[model samples]
Structures are given as structure tokens and as C-alpha cells.
Target: MTGGAGYIGSHVVRAFQQAGIPPVVLDDLSSGHRGFVPADVPFVHGSILDVPLVARTLAEHDVTGVVHLAGFKYAGVSVDRPLHTYEQNVTGTANLLTAMADQGVEAIVFSSSAAVYGTPDVDLVTEATATTPESPYGESKLIGEWLLRDQGRATGLRHTSLRYFNVVGSGTPDLYDTSPHNLFPLVLDALTQGRTPRINGTDYPTPDGTCVRDYIHVADLADAHVAAARALGEGRTLEPVYNLGSGDGVSVRQIMTAMADATGIAFEPDVAPPRPGDPARIVASGELAARDLGWRMTHTLADMVSSAWEARRAH
Candidate 1:
């Protein structure tokens, strides 16, 4: 698995191990932690941009398939760093595909994003949702999906991309989202550091006047990747892309409430002006993934909040 040391990728590594599939990790550690990958798993400390290095890793490890999750993932930051985002997400994917083809690797599972849909018009987004990405990060992810599709057609590569929504919580106490731009870490970090968490806005048209998003536990999301990889390895036809989401929406205020309850720190978030282009709501239907990959939201809102808190405290 590429990026097997990242927050999501680390969980995916564990899932693959649980399924009795030994995984070799190749990570640049730009944002990923070297400690996140297990000590037993083979680790290749390098960039996918290095075509020769990637090809060598595939050949040396006897890799049969790949679960790709490495990229510049901050949507808002991506707006200011478009070139960097494209290089890491778009060019990186292209290079990985090139290396795979060279090494005769036939299958792959891509890590896509809900950002590909931007602000959807409907209440529940599905795989059929038209992609209208608004940032470089989103656009790059969409382009990465395109690269996979084109490669699959050209080389007969077996592949699938899982479009992730707001992934949160923890599968293990040792692993959690550590991105400086992510919501959970921002809020949890503020509270732990004796600073009050702040909400961007409370004036949206939504019921709670806060932006609503579909949040899925990271562990459950990781499991979906394993299922996709297994299906592809077993020669079963899978959809080109699947949205790994919960059909329900959770507002920022609701999340704050849950955070307070989870951490035993009751404090109202300081309200700030709304961020530009902030969407009122974005939820998704995971039916397609459930039908094919046994996708399901096994954790509840409480489970998400509490598990995240526990993990945050452990760190």
C-alpha cells in the first residue's frame, strides 16, 4: 500500500493484515508518520514520484496490487497551493500507475474524496453524482480517478476508487487524523491545549445554522478498501468508484456538543465569519459500496466521538 503510514492508510494496513494479506508500505512521510506503520510490515521510505523507486519496490516486494492513499489532502490549503496539489496527487498517481505497469502489477484500490462532488445539489449523494470539484485537491483526486480509469482500459488493470466523505474517529487508539487542517484534530487540539474550539459560522440555512457533512469512522472506511482489494484480487468485477459514506448528515454544532460530552469539557465554540464557499450540507448514499464491498457504518455518532477522544487522549 502506498502511503501506508498516513492516518487512513495506517488503518488500511491493519485491515489488510487482519484479512491475512501481508502488505508492503511505500511512503514519503510528507504528512504521514513513520511510526504509524507496524514494525513488522516492510517499509519503503521514498516518493511515488520516483518512478524507478516505485517500480523497484513493486518488484522487490512481489506486490500483486496496490491501495493508493498518498496525496496532498487539505482542500482549503490546496486552493492556495494548486501546483503542489496537482504534482502530489495527479503526477504522483500517474507515476505510480507507470511503475505498476512496468512491474506487471494488475490491480489497485484508489483513495478518492467527497471533494470531487464539491457542494452537491441533492441531500444524499450517490456514485452517480456528477463531479464538480471546486479546489485543486478535489480536482486532483478526480483527475487521479481518471488516470486509473484510463490505465485500466489501456493495460486491462483491475482497479477501483473509493470516494471518502468526512472520515473521522479511530480504529485504534494509536492512530488518528493528525492533519493541522482537519476538523477533528483542530477541535481536539484546541481543547487539549486550553484553547476554545472555534466554529467558522452559525448562519447557514441549515437547521443548526452550521455546515453539515457526512462523517464516517476511519476504521469502517479502511475496511471498505480491504473489501475492494479482495474483490479485485479474486477477479470479481467492481465499480470504478464507490462513495464510502453514511447517508446521514451531522452539523458542526452537533459535533461540538458531542466533543464536549466526549472530552468532559463543556464550552461553546467561538463563532467566526463563514469561510468562503462553505456548503450548507453534503451527505451521501453508500448503497453501491454496500452492495459490492459490504460497506456499512458500524459505528454510531457516540462511538465516533468517544473513540476519537480516547485516541486523542492517548496521543
Candidate 2:
């Protein structure tokens, strides 16, 4: 699995292990942590852009499939680092595909993002929703999916892209979202440091006047990857893309309330002006994934908040 040491990737790696499918991790440790990988798991420290390296790793491990999660993932930062983002996400994905083809590794599960929809006008996004990415990060993810689609046609590669919503919480106390830009880490960090956690915007046309987003548990998200991999391995025809979402929306205010209750920090969040291109609401329907991959939200808002808090405090 490429980027198997990342926050989401690490959890996916663990899921694969629990399913009795041994995984080999290839990570550059750019945004991922070396410690996230298990001690016994095979770890290769390298970038996926190195086609030869990837091919060599696949052959060495006799890897039958790939779980790709490595890329430049910051949507806001990608605006300033467009070239960097394209090189890492687009070029890197192309290289990974080349390596996979060279090694005859026919199956792959891509870690895509809901950002491909940008700010949709609908209340619920699905696989059929039009893709109108507004950031380089989102554009790169869409391009990655395109790469897989084109490659599948050309090489008969079995592939599926999982479009993730806002993934949060911890599968275990040792694994947590460490992204500096993520809301959970930011909120938890501020409270731990005796500062007020600030909400980006609170004037959106929602019930709480804050932006609403689909939040799914990381553990649940990881299980979906395993399911997708298993389906492909069993020669089952799967959808090209599936949204790993909860078909529900959680506002920023609700998150703040959850954080306060979870951490015993009762202070209200500070408000800030809306960021550019910030979507008011971007929920999604996971009906397709549920039917195929048994995708479901096993964790509640309280579970997400408390688990993240416990993991953050642990580290």
C-alpha cells in the first residue's frame, strides 16, 4: 500500500492486517509518520514518483493489489503550491500506475476525496454528481481517478476510487488525524493549549449558520477499503467510484459543542470570516457503498469527538 503510514493509510493498513491480508507499506514520510506503521509490517521509505522503486517494491512483496493514499492533500495550500500538488498527486499517480502495470499488479483502491465536487448545490452528493473541483488538490484527485479509469481500459486493471468525506476520529488510541489543517486536531490543540478554538464561518445558510460537512469515522472508512479490495480480488465488478460518506451533515457548531462536552472544555468557539470557496454544506449519500461495501457509520458525533480527544491527549 502506497502511503500506508499516513493517518488514513495507517488505519487502512491495520484493517488489512486484521483481515489477515498482510500489507507492505511504501511511504515518503512527507505528511505521514514512520511510527504509524507496525513494527512487523514491511516498510519502504520512498516516493511513488519513482516508478522503478515502486515496481521493485511490488515485485519484492509479490503484491497483488495497491491501496493508494499518498499525495499533496491540502486543498487550501494547493492553491499556492499548484505545481507541487500536481507533481505529487498527478505525476506520482501516473508513476504508480506505470509501476503497477510493469509488475502486473492488476488491482488497486484509490483514496480519492469529496473535494472533486467543490461546492455542490445539492444537499446530498453521489457518484453521479458533477465534478467541479475548485482547488489544485481536488483537481489532482479527479485526475488520479481519471488515470485509473484510463489505465483500466488500456491494461484491464481492476480499480476503484473511494471518495472520502471529512474523515475523523481514531481507530485506536495510537492512531489519530495529525493534519495541521484538519478541524479535530486544530480544535483539540487549541483547548489543550488554553486557547479558544475558532470556527471559520458561522453565517452559512444552515440550521446553525455554520458550514455543514459529512464526517465519517476513520475506522469505518478503513473497513470500506478492505471491502473494496476484497471485492476486486474476488473478481466482482464494482463501481468506478463510491462516496464513503454518511449521508448526513454535521455543522461546525455541533462539532464545537461535541468538543466541549468531550474534553470538559466549556468555552464557546470564536468566529471568523468565511474562507474563500468555502462550501456552506457538502453532505453525501453512501447508499452505493453501503450496498456494495457494507459502508455505514458505526460511530456517532460523540464517538468521533471523544475518540479523537483521547488519541490527541495520548500523544
Candidate 3:
């Protein structure tokens, strides 16, 4: 698994270990922590852009398949750093695929994102949703999917991309989202620093007025990824992409309420204007993942908050 030392990647590493699959991790530690990777798993400190290193790792481990999760993931920042985003996401993915081809590793599970469907007109996005990415991050991911598809046709590579919505919560107390821009960490950081968590806007058309989005627990998302990898390894015909999401979504106000309840902080959140281009609602249907990959929303909204709080406190 590439990027196996980051927040989501670490959880997926644990899941793969639990499933009795030995995982070799390659990470540059740019945003990933060395401590996040299990001591037993073999770790290679390198970037995916290092094609020779990637090829060597695959050969050394006799790697049969790959779980590609390494990339520049910030969507808002991607707008300002388009070239950096392309280099990390686009060029990095190309190098990894090239290395895999050289080493005869034919299967991959791609970590895609919902950003590919930027500001969609539909209420619930599906696999068939027309991709119109608004940020370089989303565009890079879409191109990554295209690369996988093209490689599959040319070299008989088998692959599937898992496009996720907002991933929150924690499967283990030791692992949590550390990104400063993510909502969970931002709220928890405010509380820890003796400040009130703030909501951007609460006057939208939705029932709660705050933005509603699909937030899936990271552990559940990891499970779906492993399922996809297993299907690919077993040579089962799989779709090119699947959305790991809840058809229903939770609002930002709801998240704040859950945070207050979970952390025992009762102060009302401060309100601010909505961020530009912020959509009022963005949810996805996971029926396809459920049918093929055992995807499910195992954690409730309250469960997501509490687990996340516990993990944040531990950190």
C-alpha cells in the first residue's frame, strides 16, 4: 500500500493486516508519520515519483497487487498550487503505474475522491455522474482513473477506483485525521485550544440551513478498499469506479451538535459567511459498492463524533 503511513492509509494497513494480508508500505513522510505504520510491516521511505524505487519495492516484496493512496489531497489548496498538485497526483500516479507494469503487478485499488463531481446538479451522485472537476486535485484524480483504464486496455491490468466523500471518525484511537483543513480536526482543535467551534453558514435551503455532506467513517471506507482489492486479486469483474458514501447525509450544524455532545462542551458555535463555491448539499448513493464490495455505513453520526473525539483526545 502506497502512503500507508498517513491517516486513512494507516487505517487501511491495519484492515489489511486484520484480513491476514501482508502489506508493504511506501511513503515519503511528507505528510505521513513514521509512527503510524505498524512496526511489523516493512516500510520503504520514498516517494511514488521514484519509479526505480517503486519497481524495486514491488520486486522485493513479490507484490501481486497495489493499493494506491499516495497523493496531494487538499482540494481548496489545490486551486492555488495546480502544478504541485499535478506533479504529485498525476505524475506520481503515472510513475507508479509504469513501475507496476515493469514488475508485472497488474491489479490496483485507487483512492479517488468525490471532488471529481464538483458542484453537481443531482441530489445524489452515482458512478454515472458526469465528472466536471473544479480543482486540480479532482482533475488529477480523474486523470488517474483514465490512466488506469488506458493501462488496463493496453496491458491487461485489472483495477478499480474508489471515490470517497468526506471521510471522518476513527477505527482506532491511535489514528485520526491530522489535516488542519478538515472539519473534524478543526472543530476538535478549537475545543482543545479553549475556543468555540464556528459554523460557516446556517441559512441554506436545507432543514438545518448548514451544508449537508456525506461523511463516512474512515474504518468503513478502509474495509471497502480491502474488499475491492480482494475482488481484483480474485479476478472478479469489477466496475471501473465505486462511490463509498451514504445516500443520506448529515449537516454541519448536526456535526457541531454532535461535537458538543461528545466533548462535553456546551457553547454554541460562532457563525460566519459560507465559503465561496460551498455547495448546499452533496451526498452519494453507495448501492453499487454495497452490491460488489460489502460497503456499509456502520457508524452513526453520533458514533462518528464520539470516536473522532476519543481519537483526538488521545492525540
For candidate 1, report its TM-score.
0.97
Off by over 4 Å in 1: none
Reference-based lDDT, residue 190, model 1: 94
Compare candidates 2 and 3 on TM-score and give the better one: 3
lDDT (Cα, tens digit) per residue for candidate 2, span 203-305 = 8899989999999999999999999999999999999999988788799999999999999989988889998878799999999999998778799999999
Worst-scoring 10-residue span by lDDT in model 3: 293-302
The lDDT for every candidate, in the order shown, is 0.93, 0.94, 0.95
- lDDT by residue (126-198, candidate 1, tens digit) is 9998999999999999999999999989999999999988889999899988888788889999999999999
The candidate that wins on lDDT is 3
lDDT of 3: 0.95
* Per-residue lDDT of 285 in model 1: 88
Error of 1 at 169 (Å): 1.1
Highest-scoring model, TM-score = 3
